[model samples]
Target: MKNFEIIANLLKEIWPEHHAKLTSEICQLSSDDAFLLDYIAEKIILIKKDKLKQAIKNYKQTCAVIVQEEIHFRRTQSYRLKTEQQADTEIYSNSSFMDMYLDGLLISQLFWSNHFKVFQFFCSSFLTQISKDDTLNRFVEIGPGHGLFLSEIVKKLPSRECLGYDISESSLRHTSQALQSLECAANVQLINKDIYNLPTDQNFDAIILSEVLEHLEAPQEILTKLSHHLTPKGLLFINVPVCSPAPDHIYLFKTPNEVQDMITSCGFRVNETRYFPMTGYSLERAIKSQATISVAAICQLST
Candidate 1:
C-alpha cells in the first residue's frame, strides 16, 4: 500500500548505488575490450542500468517460482518425516518446556545457531503460506524459539514489521541472527519478555502461539494475555501439536476442535482449523477421530 511517488523517491536513492556497482564491473574490462569501443561511454552507462533493471525484475520472478516449487515439494514429502517424528516422540517418557527449547535449538529454523538447513527451509515455507494471505499481516509470534518464523516474515513481508516475545535469552540471541540473515531483519523485533508483560500499546495484524502454550502450567493465562494483546480486527494463528508426543507437550488438546473451544472461551472467535496430517495415526482414523499432530488456524478477534 505504498504510493508510487514514495517508490520513485526510493528508486532515485537506489539508482546511484546500483549504477556504482554496475560501473564497477565494467571498469574491470581492459581499455582494448572490443565491446566497450563499440559503444560510447554514455551509451555504456545506459546499457548497464538497463541490464541491472532487467536482472532485478528477473530476481523477483525467480523468488515467486522458487516459492511455488517449494510448496509442491513439502506437500509430496509431508507424510514420511511426519511419521518418523511421531515414532521418536513416543520414546520420550517425560518432556518439559526446557527440553523442547533445547530440541528446537538443535533443529528448528527459529535459531540460526543450529546450522540446520532443512529446518530453515521449512520455516520459510511456513511464512510463505502465512504471508500470501493479506489478512495475516501485522504479526506477532510468541515463543518463536530461535525466531525462524520472524526471519521468514522479514523476507516475505518487510512492510509488516513483526515483533516476537519469549522468556529465554539464548533463544532470543539465535532468533536475532536468523532474522538478520534474511535481509528482512528490520521488520522484526525480538524481546526477552514474558506473556504477563505483554506490550499493550502495540496492536498486531496476526498473533502466533506456536507450541508454547501447551508447555505452560496455565495455558489460560497465556491465551488471555494474548487475547488482550491482539488487534480488535486482526487474525490469530495458533499451532498446537495433537497426537504426536513431545518432551514439552505436558498439556494436550487432543484435537483442533478442542483447542477451538478453548480459544473461543478466551474471547477469540476461531474461523477455521486445519489439522496437519500427522504420522502414527492411520489416516482414516485421524480423519474420523480428529486426532492429528498439529493445529493451525485463522481466527477473528473477539470484542
Candidate 2:
C-alpha cells in the first residue's frame, strides 16, 4: 500500500479533489495490481508531466464532443461517423495527436474515478476468468494500446507465449516499454500490423480485443475474423464502451445487450459479462441517459 500511497500523493498534487476517491479505489486493488497502477502513474508523471495539463484539457474536449454526439444521437438515433475513413480524419490517422490522445487515456485510467472502474474490473474479474483457465498456453491481444493489460497477462501467465498486434506505432512503443519495464520473461512478440495482415493459419489459446471494437466501422467483421484464429476451446476477451464517444470512437453501442448479442452472433458463446457504469451513475442511469459505461466479456468458440 506504500506504493499506492505514493501514487495517491502524486495524484493529489495534480488533482486535489480526486485524491481521496482515487486512493480509496486504488487501495481496493490486489497488491500486484496496485503496484502496476502506481507504475503507470509514475511513468506518466516522469515522461509526460509537462503534457499532463494539456492531456487533461484534451480529455475535457473529448467529453465535450461526447456530449455533442449524444445530442446528435438523440435527434437522429445514429452515430456521428458511419465509416473508419471519417474517424481517421477525426483522430487515429494523426500520429502526433494520437500520441497525446493515448497519454490522456492513461491519465484517465490513473486519476479519473469512472475510468478507474474499468481498470479495476479488468484487474479483478477479467484476470480471475483467465486464471481459472489452466489449459491456456498461447495468448494474443489485438490493439493492446497502453500495454498495461497485456503486461499483466505476461506477468501472471509467465509460462504462456504471448503475441500482440496493433496498427499504431505509438501503441506498439508503449506496449513494448510496458512489457520491458515489468521485466516479463515470457516469450512475447509485438507486431505492428492490422488484424487483416496477420497470418490466417495460426491460432491461439486466448485472444484479447479490449477497447478496440467500438473504434472500427465493422466490429462484427473483426470479431468474425478473430473467431477463426481462436482454437475450439480458446478464450476470447473483449471490452467495449456503451454510449462512450471519444475523438476516435466511431461505432456507438447503446446498451450492454447490444454488445452481448454482437459477440454471440459472431459465433462465440459468452461466458461472463461485466458492466461498470460511469462515476456518479448507476447502470440504469447510464443506459437511460446515454452516459458512458464499460462493458467487458469473456467467451469461447461456439460448438
Candidate 3:
C-alpha cells in the first residue's frame, strides 16, 4: 500500500486537478491488486525514470500519427496495413521503437486512468475465474508485453506453471525480468516465438491474449488455434481496443459487439464482457467520437 501511496502522490504532483479522484480510484482496488499495481509503478519509477519520461513524451508524438491514420481510416473504412508482415517490418522489428512503446505501456497501465481501469478489470475478472475453478494450473500468455498481468498471475496462483510466447525478443526479456523481480516460486518460461509456431498438441488450463488481436492481420486465426489448444474447460482471457489507433495497431474493431462476435465465431462462448472508455469520456462519447475504448472478455470452448 505504501507503493500505491507513492504512485498517488506522484500522480497528484503531475496532475493536481485530478488528485482527489485519482486517490479515490486507487483506494478502490483490493489490497492484493493494489500491491501488484504498485509493483509495476515502482518498477517504472525506480529502474529508469528518465527513460519512462521519454517514452511518455514519445507517446504524445505517436498520437499525432494515430490521428492522421484515423482520418484516413474514417475516409477509407479500412486499416492501412494489408498484412501482418508489414507490421513486423515496420513496428515489431524496430527494437528501439518497441522498447519505448513497451515502456510507455508500463507507465500507462499505472498512471493512465483508462488503462488502469482496464487492468483492474483484467485482475478482477481473473480472480473471479479462479474462484470458480481453482484447478487452473497450466497457463499460457501470448504477447505478454509489459508482463504485469503475468506477474500478477504468478503471484496469485503460485502453484501454476506459465509459458509466455512473444514475437519480440524485447518483450520476452522484459517479461522474464519482471517475473524475476517478483521473486515468486511459480514456474515461468518466456520464449521469443510467434504463437502460431507453438506446438499444437499442448493444451493449457488458462490462456491469455490481451491487447494482441488488433496487432494481427487475422486475429480469428490465432483465436481458433488457441481454442484448439485449450483444455476441455479451460478459460481464455482477451482484451482489445476499439477505435484505438496506434502505430502498430493494424486491425480495427468498431464496436465491443464486434469483438464478442469474433470470439464466438472462433468457437469460444463468451461468459463476460467489460468495457472502459478513455479517461473523461463516457462510452457513448468515446464511440461517437471514434475515441479509444478498451474491451475485455472471458470465454471458454462452446458447448
Candidate 4:
C-alpha cells in the first residue's frame, strides 16, 4: 500500500493520537506506507498483539497508562522515542493493531482491579466524608467499577440506600453481578446514563466522585452542575489522580491544592484531604514510586 493510503486507513480505524511529534513523523512518511511499516517494525520489539489487545481493553475499562517519549526538538516536533503501552498489560501502535486487526478481543476486563487498597480507601473515605451524620442515607456513587467499594459501603451502613451510576453498560453489569454475589445487591441500585444531563428531581445526601473527574472533558462544569444535585449541607466525597499519567486522564491535578481549589470554586467547603502517591518507570527503571492518590471530601453548605 502507498504511504498516503496507509495514513488514510489509520485515520479511519482509530482517532489519531493527538501527539504532535507522532503526527508529524507519520505525515513525513506520506506516500511511503511500506517504509512507514518498516520504520515502525524496526522500532517495535517485545510488544505483542495479545498485549496490545489487553492494553486497549485496560484503557477503555479502567485506569491505564500510555507511556511514550516526550520528544521535542525545541518548538518543532520530532519523533525519536515513543511507544504505546498498556499500564499493566501490553504495548502497540496504530500499525501493530492493523497488522493483527483487533476485532476478536474480548471486552471482559473492564472490571479488572489489581489495586484494591487504593480503591478501598477511595470508597470508604468518599462516603465517610459525605455523611456528616452518624447515618449516611441516600448516597450515589458515579462510575462504580467492579462494585467492590459498593460492597464495602453495604457492610458499613447496611440501612442506607446506595446507588451506583455508570455510562458503561458492561461496567453496570459487572457491578450488578459483583454486588449480587455478595448478597448486597438489595442495598444498591445501578444506573446506566449520561451523568452530565441526568434528569432527576432526586438529590443525594452524599455523592461520590472517586477518581472520575480526570476522565471528563470539562471536569469543572460537571462538578459545578453536581453542586446542585447534592442536598443542602450534603457532603461531596471526591477522589482524583493528583499526578497519574494515563491516556484518558486529561486533567493532571499536579497537587492536592489544585483539586481543592477546583472544588472550592464549585462553592464547596473543603473539610479534609489526603494524597495517595503512585509512580511508574520507563520500562527501563528498576522501580517507579507510585504517585500520591489524593482523596478529599467537600461539603455543599446550606447558607
Highest lDDT scorer: 3
Task: Name the regions of candidate 4 deviating beyond 4 angstroms.
Answer: 1-135, 279-292
Clashes of each: 6, 0, 0, 14
* Model 4 C-alpha lDDT per residue in residues 32-96, reported as the tens digit of each score: 43343432222111122334334333333332212332212122232222221231123222334
Candidate 1 at residue 237, lDDT? 71
Question: All candidates: CA RMSD in angstroms?
Answer: 16.9, 3.7, 3.7, 15.7
Candidate 1, 88: how far from true, in Å?
23
RMSD of 1: 16.9
State how far residue 208 of model 3 sits from its true place (Å). 0.6
lDDT of model number 1 = 0.52
**Per-model CA lDDT versus the true structure:** 0.52, 0.75, 0.77, 0.53
- Per-residue lDDT for 165 in model 2? 93
Q: What ranges in model 1 sit over 4 Å off?
A: 1-137, 280-283, 287-292
RMSD score of candidate 3 (Å)? 3.7
Compared with the true structure, model 2 gives a TM-score of: 0.82
Error of 2 at 83 (Å): 2.1
Q: For model 3, what is the C-alpha lDDT against the true structure?
A: 0.77
Best by TM-score: 3
TM-score of each: 0.55, 0.82, 0.84, 0.57
Estimate, for each residue in 5-89, the C-alpha lDDT of model 3 and write its tens digit.
6656655555565567666666666877677677667765554444544655544445456678778778877678767888888
Cα distance off (Å), candidate 1, residue 33: 48
| Greater-TM-score candidate between 3 and 4 | 3
